[model samples]
Target: MAGGSFRKSLGYALAGLAYTLRTQPNMRFHFGAALVVVAVALLLGVGVRDLLIILFAIALVVIAEMFNTAVETVVDLYTAKYHPLARVAKDVAAGAVLLAALNSVVVGLLVFYPYLHAFVRFWARSWRGGN
Candidate 1:
């Protein structure tokens, strides 16, 4: 029973991912940004802790965008015409995504800035040493 339930949950999660990929432009952008972050972290030789932080931030932004998309879709389904409260609901959902994306940006900068700085400094020192 537990095994069956786990499989069902996994299937549902995959379906949700598929839906987002099919319908959401923002999801695509977030996914592309996530790939860039991962590549940057790898190039910078970020440690395990930094990688975890980066992953968490990426996940946070993606999840928030997914939730925002869901809310907007539901609102549109319920109302064919313009309504102030429906607009407010959609706006609030978008705001949530914006806030989460901002937080992710802060997290990425905080976690990676030192590594980036050190990389630049190392290159500068090596160039000077070579000269």
Candidate 2:
């Protein structure tokens, strides 16, 4: 009974995560970027370990974006009017998200480049062999 309850709680948590990803524009962007990574990984035939690394990178960007959004929301709620300091704070928070997103892109390219090159080479070899 206790185990079942724990599993239900986990499910709810996962559902909440999904809801956030679906509803939040920034999260949706991150999710779309992640889908692109997954497509690249599939094309490159990424191994399990590489896949884990990619997942970690994606998670990092998503978490950073989420935190940035939360900070912006809190600032807006508290200030409710245009203030130079509030604008600076929001911009800084957004910049952090942008940095995280760029970092994730770099990490994805680094991790997948080798596999992509190898896959291309293998395809070329097989095509030549068949001819």
TM-scores of the models, in the order given: 0.92, 0.77
Model 1, residue pairs in steric clash: none
> Could you say which candidate leads in TM-score?
1
Q: What is the C-alpha RMSD, rounded to one decimal, of candidate 1? A: 1.5
Q: What is candidate 2's lDDT per residue for 1-131, written digit by digit as tens?
A: 99999999999877767766776887897898799888978877898998998898888888877777677778979988899998988898889888988888888888888987887788898999954
Q: Which ten-residue region of model 2 has the weakest summed lDDT? A: 14-23
Residue 107 displacement (Å), model 2: 0.8
lDDT of 2: 0.83
Worst 10 residues of 1 by lDDT: 122-131
lDDT of all predictions, in order shown? 0.91, 0.83
Q: In terms of TM-score, how similar is model 2 to the real structure?
A: 0.77
What lDDT, from 0 to 1, does candidate 1 have? 0.91
- Model 1 lDDT per residue over 1-131, tens place: 99999999999999998899789999999999999999999999999988998899889888888888889989999998999999999999899889989998999989999999999898998989944
